[model samples]
Target: MRLLIIAPEQIPVPPPVGGSVENCIYQIAKQIKGNHEVTIVSLYRKHLPRTTRVGRATIIRVDGGSKSNYLRNAIKQVKGNRYDLIQIDNRPSFIRAMKQAFPNTPISVFMHSMTFVSKPVTTPSKAALDLGRANLIIGNSQSLKRTLGSKFPAQKHKVKYVHLGVDLKKFHPSGKSGAKPFHILFAGRLIPRKGIPVLLKAVQIARRSVPSIRLSIAGGTGKPAYKAYLRQTAKSLGIPVTFTGGLSRRQMPVFYRTGSCFVCPSQKHEAFGLVNVEAMASGLPVIASKIGGIPEVVQHGRNGYLVGAYHRPEAFASQIVKLAKQPELTKRLARQARIDAVQRFSWTQTASKLTRIYEGHLNRRQG
Candidate 1:
């Protein structure tokens, strides 16, 4: 099969910065190359090689002036290519352009998260309707499917849940068993929606119980003002929190391995917590809020603790304290989490499942 993948311009392929969607595409392309011809259409800010090969797939970088122009140029590029199957990552703005460009081709839209809900309520419903055109819609979690199912009932049959995969080889348990500071790590965009302030408040409470606990935050500030507010809150609370702005994918394993527990306290309806899976694969027990698809990833007492989404600093702090006090339980849960992650969330398995979806679409088109 000849496959053409269209990805957003905000992140590059084999992204220098960390991105789950880009990483997933890179992995799937590499795995499918032995059997299928894969071509990736990526965005370029400045001048780049128009055509090149990354791993096994051919990469085509297109110059897009703005989001609108990018999608237009992408449509133009695909119009000239010969592809049996077309796969596009979630970006609502490109829906109309994609439908117009490849009206006859079997197209599949893979949703990392629904972008339409992020917009204003007054906006027109074209984006939601355009999504219905795809032969298949792949969502990263069951919650995402339910959300889409409610929003676009006509296209419910097209929507299917296929969770993203983590690289087990890259993320695994560190054998270091020495007495270390109770290091807690948080990795994600420092945005208000991510609920970083809630984590900071919980850290303040945790410090009262476990004075030696250390919190390290890794990720760039998607909103600079929010990051500043978090810093001020931490200062006022006298919480010992270190914000490590933006670590690359290579640097993430070090933070994961060193930390006793990984925390993701998002307040929004997260489609799937990719960072949660990454932490599990790293053999680190997670402490997350009981919201969105977080429950699907973190089993309450089996892998780690899940606190209420409401502002319960004491409750959140107690979970951290409990983990700190019981090192054996923490270690056992982390080990089991690692095993579960490796067994269930490998890119090989994800790609194989995706291949079946593509084959199904191809078969339907042929018949």
Candidate 2:
């Protein structure tokens, strides 16, 4: 099968920066190339070495000014070629353009996260209608599928939930042992939707009970003003918070391994908490908010605790304190987390499932 994948415009293929969507694209493309001809159409923001062959896939960077032009060029490329399937990664603007470009193609739109919840101000009803035109829609979590189903009932049958997978080898437990201060880690874009402020407030309350507690925040700041606000909030509360800006994917394992627990207190709009799976894979218990797809990933009390999404700082603080005081409980949950992460969230399994979806579409088209 010949497959063409369209990624979001933030970065081109072989992205210099780190992102979950980019990483997933790279891994899935590499795997699919073994059996199918894969071509990645991405933005040419930075200089790419003309054309590069990754695994068995050929990555083509298209230069364009506006979103329409990007879609125009992409459709032009496909018009001359015979592709078995077209897969577009999540992006409302790109998806809208692609639908216009390839009206009859067996297109599949993969949702990385909910656009409406991610950006509360923007209404995605029209975008969701555009997405309904696709032959199939793939969501990263059950929560995402339900959300989309409720929003666009006309295309509910087209929406399928396929959980994202993690590379177990790259994100496993480090054997190094030694009890240190209770270190909590948060790795994601520094945005309000991520509930970073909530996590900060929770840390402040937890510190009163466990003074040795420490919080390490990794990831780039999307909104400078919000980042500044977070800093001020931390200072006002007298919480020891360290912001590591951003780290490459290669460096993430170190942070995951060193930390005692991972917290993702996202309020809503989070389709799937990829970091939770990554942390669980690294043998660290997770403390995620009970919202969105978090509960589906983190088994409360089994792998980690799930605090109420709308709870105040005291609630989050109490959970942290409980985990800190109960070393035996933490150890049990962390052990199970490691086992579950490795068994359930393997990239090999995810790629295989995706391959089947592509094959099914191609088979139907041929029939």
Candidate 3:
């Protein structure tokens, strides 16, 4: 099948900087390349190539001044391309325009996250109407589907859940456990929503029980003020924090392997926690918030523990202390995490699921 995937203007398909949606698309594209003709259309940035091929998939960039203009130009650029299915990522408002552009074609809108990311100008009813036009709507998690279902009951039947996949080979056990001087790892954007400050507080509290514990942060800060605040807080608490800034995809696995445990203390409502799975894949016992779709991945007492988010650093601290104190429990959870990650989350499985969805949509359209 010929497939056209439309990504948000903020990032590219291959994603120069780390992005969940882009990485998801890249993986799906790579996995389905042998069987399908895949093309990713993204907003043009001066730094990115106009057109390039990654394996069997072709990435094309379109020039425009604004977000609206970018979408318009992207649609214009792909006007003549023949595609069996068109899959767009998390943009309900644009569904109507895209439908008008290709009236006969089957289009599927793949929702990667929550509605906050899209921020569509249209009303709820209008957005639902736009979504109704699409042949299918894919959600990354059941939490996303439930929320989207409540928001747009008219299109609820269209919603389907497909858990995001992780690269099993790249992220696996480091073959060494209970390393000396236990380290806690946090990797994500250094923003308020990521709960970086909360992690610092948790580290401070955990250190009383586990004095040898150290915190290592690996993520780029979009806001300098927040970064400053985090550094100041860490220094004030005398907590040893190492900020490695942003890391590329190639460096992520090694970073995760170096840490004894992974913490994702997000304050915001996460549609899904990709980092939690990645950490689990690396054989690290994950300590994430018990909110949103996180529970779907982190099974408490089985693979990892889920604590409360926000200002409750003590909850996180308790978990960290527990893992540090109990070496046998930590090793058990880490082993289970790796086994679960490999069994449940694989790009090959994701691609196969997506392929079946694509075929079903195409068949329905043809019929």
Candidate 4:
């Protein structure tokens, strides 16, 4: 089968800068490419080649401007290619044009987040129409699927949930011994929605119980004011917080391996928390908020603990304190997290299931 994936225009495919959606596109394409002919279209970078082939897949980067330009260029580049399936990532702006370009082709629109990151796709009527044109609609989590279904009941039947996957081999336990067992890690954009402030407060509370507790935050900061506020807050609270700006995919493994636990204290609803799975894969116990699709990933006292109430510092602090105190419990959770990651959330499983989805749709189209 020949497949083409239309990705977001802002992020590069293969993710040199590091984005979950970009990583997802690359990983899925890489995994499925062995069995199918895959091609990806993403934002062009001056430093990278315009077109390149990785494994069995081809990547084409185009110069981007407005969403209109992206849509036009994407359709132009992919015009002559005979693809078995077309998958558009997140942006609804490309949908109408792509559908027109490949009239008979089966197109699947994947929604990785709750809302569009692009301004053009945020328009309700246009987004609705663009969404309606897809042959199938896929959400990264069931939580997101529910939200989408509720918002656009007409497309409910088309909506399906396909949980994101992590690269197990790349993210596995280091097996390296003797590191700081109380080191907490948070990786994501330094934004209000990520619940960074909440995490800082939780760390302050946790340190009262476990004095050795520390936090290492890794992610890019678009809002300088917010970043400065976080630093000042950490200082005032006297919580030892280290902010390592924007780690690439390569740098993430080291951070994961070094940290004792992963905390994703997101105040806003996460479509699916990829960090939880990544941490679990790295053999670190995860402590995430019990909201959105996070609960779907981290089971309370099973693989990891979930902070029940939204942004409750004490609740998160208590979990950290418990983990610090009970080495045996932490070991159990970490071990289970690794096992679960391998069994349930590897890229292999994701690829296989996605293959079924594609094949099922293709067969129906043929019949």
Candidate 5:
């Protein structure tokens, strides 16, 4: 099968830093390249070539001054290429044009989050029309599928969920565990929805019991004001915190190594907590909110604990303290977390499942 994966014209494929959606496209393409002929079309990056071969798959980068130009260039690049399947990542707007370009092909829109499917980015009716056009619609988690279904019931039957994965080998633990100066790690974009302020408060409260506890947030703060506010909030709360800025994908393992435990105190519902999976793969137990798809991965008392009253800092802090006070329990949970990641969530498995879905659409078309 020949698969053409179109990444949003924003980030380059195999990007240097945290490009969750871009990285997912590359990882899935790489894993399935052996069995299926794959080609990834992404925006041009200065450091990367216009066309390059990685393993058996091909990557084609196009000019991307803006979304429309990037889309036009990408369509121009793959104008006459024969593909068994075409996958568009995170862009509902591309669906109409892509369908017009490849009228005979099966096009699927893979949503990494709800960002593109709702207002501000797109209107309900427009998103509905675009998504309804796809042969298949995929979400990264059941929580996301359910949520989207609630909003767009007419297209619910077309929507399916596939959990994103982690590279187990790259993120494996260093076989080291320490609790002397316990580190609480949070990894994600520094958005208000991520609940970083709540994390700061949680750390402040947890410090009373675990005085050695400190916080490290490893992500880029896109806005200067938000960065300043976070720092000021941490300082005011008397919490010792370090904003590690943004670390590249290569640097993530080292950041994971510095943590005693990972926390995902999101104020809103998550689609699929990919960062939590990465932390778990790195052998750091997760303490995250019970809402959304998080509970599906964290599994209270197994790999990590899930806080019910997620918005309350005290709820998160209590879980943080639980892990802090019981070093042996922490190590046990950490070990199991790694086991869960390896057994359940791996790039190879993610590729296989996604391939099965693609083939399903293909077979139906043939019939």
Candidate 6:
């Protein structure tokens, strides 16, 4: 089967730097390309050619100056081609036009978050019509899947879930045998919903019990003013914080391996905290919120501790102090985290599941 993947106008595919959505697209396409002819259409990036073949998949880059130009150019690029399926990542608005362009081909709209499905991006009525055209609507987590279902009850039947995966080989245990400071790593966008402030407050409280506590905040490219605000907050709290300013895919594993533990104190509902899984895979114990699909990744008291009231600093502080005081316990939890990540969440597993889902849907439709 020939599969054509349509990435959002925001980022470029593999070889070029991208966020979670781009990374997922590149990995999934790479995983299934051996069985199917995979083609990726993504926005233009500097120092990369318009068309290039990576492994088995062909990547086509187009001008993404505007959404209209992006869609128009992307459609024009594939004018004379035919495909068994077309996968559109994150952008719900692209579905209707894509469906019209390739009338008979089955189109799958894979949503990473609730952002594109709600608010200024789309209205309920428009979203319903757009999503209704999709043969499959994939959410990265069960939490996201359920939210999408609740939002569009009419299209609920089409909604399904496929958890995002992390590269095991790339992200593995880098033993910090005698590292001085106990690093609490947080990797994600510097958005309000990420709850960086909560983590800072927690770190401040935990420092009362464990003086060797420090934070390594990894993520970048938002308003600089907000980042400065975070710096100010950390200073006021008298916490030692290091902002790595967006580590690359290669740089991430080093940071994870060097850290003592990973924390995800999200104030809002995370569809799926991909970083938690990545941290687990890197042999670091995860301390994350109990909300959303986070619980599914970080098992409470098993691999890592899950703070119930994520917004409250005390809840997270207690957990942090627990891990800091008990080095042996932290190691044990880290071992279990690695085990869980290896046994449960892997690219091989996610890829197989995705492949099966695609086959099941397309085969059923054909039959």
- Candidate 6 regions exceeding 4 Å error are 15-18
The weakest ten consecutive residues by lDDT in model 2 span: 116-125
Residue 245 of model 4, lDDT score = 93
Question: Which prediction has the highest TM-score against the true structure?
Answer: 5
Question: How much is 161 displaced in model 5, in angstroms?
Answer: 1.4
Provide the lowest-lDDT 10-residue window in model 4: 117-126
lDDT of 6 by residue, 1-367 (tens): 7889999888788634337898898887777735688899998988789998877789999999999899999999996798999999999899888978999999999999888877787888888888988999999888988999998998899888988888999999986576467889999999899999999999999999999899999998569999999999999999899998888888888889878999999988889999999999998999999998898898898999999988899999999999999888999999999999999888767777887888899889889
Report how far residue 266 has shifted in candidate 6, in Å.
0.6
Compared with the true structure, what per-residue lDDT tens digits does model 5 show for residues 1-367?
8999999887899888988999998888788845689889998989888898877589999999989999999999998989999999999889999999999998888988898988899999999999988888889999998988888899898888888899988998877644368889999999899999989999999999989998999998678899899999998898899999999999998899888999999888888989999999999999998878898799999999998998899999999999899899999999999999999999888888999998887898789
Tell me the number of clashing residue pairs for each predicted model.
0, 0, 0, 1, 0, 0
Candidate 4 lDDT over residue span 47-70, tens digit each: 889998988889999988877787
- 104-197 per-residue lDDT for model 1 (tens digits): 7777888888765346622436756667677788888889989888888888888888877888888888988978889999999887778878
lDDT of 2 by residue, 318-339 (tens): 8889888888887889999999
lDDT of 5 at 154: 92
Clash list (residue pairs), candidate 6:
none
Cα distance off (Å), candidate 2, residue 56: 2.6
Quote each prediction's TM-score. 0.94, 0.92, 0.93, 0.96, 0.98, 0.97
lDDT of each: 0.82, 0.81, 0.86, 0.87, 0.90, 0.89
